[model samples]
Target: MADVILYRWSTERDTWVSASEVEEARAYLARQGITTSALPDGRFALAGESARAFGAERLVFLGLQQLRGTRSA
Candidate 1:
């Protein structure tokens, strides 16, 4: 398995939205003027070096890659 990171933007709205409900919420991100890319293993990498050069927290986007070893499917 490979480690993946997801970059998430803070919501300016006072309310919350469900993940499934906001899967197509790229528009909300465009409003922030930040360009992001969703990477393999469900990770999101920063497209720019501005704002904060940070990685994901709580295994949300900073987990180590699972080494390929002997295993049976």
Candidate 2:
């Protein structure tokens, strides 16, 4: 099974948003003027207080399945 990493955004009006891709999350961070540095471990390190102010966290989505064929009933 493969795992996917996603970003969870802060709640708003009892609702929340998540970024499904790295670029998507980076775009949002960039808009907030939050800089991210690449770590030697292939992970990102958020810069400054934006980390706390952003209120976003990394989440792991596991056991994702992509069905390739239609089911026969």
Candidate 3:
């Protein structure tokens, strides 16, 4: 399993939209002039500007750290 980070963006009208994929999330952040950084723990961290723009109330991390281990089956 791959460790993927999820993100949700809020429009100016206050409507929220969830990213369907990692790339989508990245693109959205990029469009907002946000830069993402890879942390040593194998997680992505949003830049300060991005974080502020995303708003603590509007940003959500779904299933974060759920893919920390390999699946056996």
Candidate 4:
């Protein structure tokens, strides 16, 4: 399966936070062994394992997208 890109909602900003804005949270997730990558469009992504492990309430499901060029086997 392909990785899924995720966006986090920011109550303070009242919108979805950009990739750069998610760095702090990304770092925290990294410590827990859930690696995420920054996207060119100012979003972040998680692989299959990481995605399954991530359960942050701030994550915006509306913006969740599966990366292109990958298919489930």
State which candidate has the highest lDDT: 4
Measured on C-alpha atoms, candidate 1 has an lDDT of 0.34
Q: Which portions of model 2 miss their true places by more than 4 Å? A: 1-20, 49-73
RMSD to true structure for each model, in Å: 15.4, 13.1, 13.3, 11.9
Instruction: Write one digit per residue (lDDT tens) for candidate 1, span 36-68.
Output: 555555535555744434323312222211112
* Number of the predicted model whose TM-score against the real structure is largest: 4
lDDT of 3 by residue, 6-63 (tens): 2222225333334444445555556556566544543466777434333222333322
Score candidate 3 by TM-score against the native.
0.34
Per-prediction backbone clash count: 3, 0, 0, 0
* Candidate 3 segments whose C-alpha is farther than 4 A from its true place: 1-20, 49-73
Rank the candidate models, highest TM-score first: 4, 2, 3, 1
Could you tell which candidate, 2 or 4, scores higher by lDDT?
A: 4
**Pairs of residues clashing in candidate 4:** none
lDDT tens string, model 2, 12-69?
3222324344445555455556566555554566676334322223411101111111
Model 4 lDDT per residue over 1-73, tens place:
0112232233343354444434555665565565676545444567563343332324333123211212232
lDDT of 2 at 49: 36
- Model 4 residue 10 CA deviation in Å: 9.8
lDDT of 4: 0.41
Provide the global lDDT of candidate 2 against the true structure.
0.37
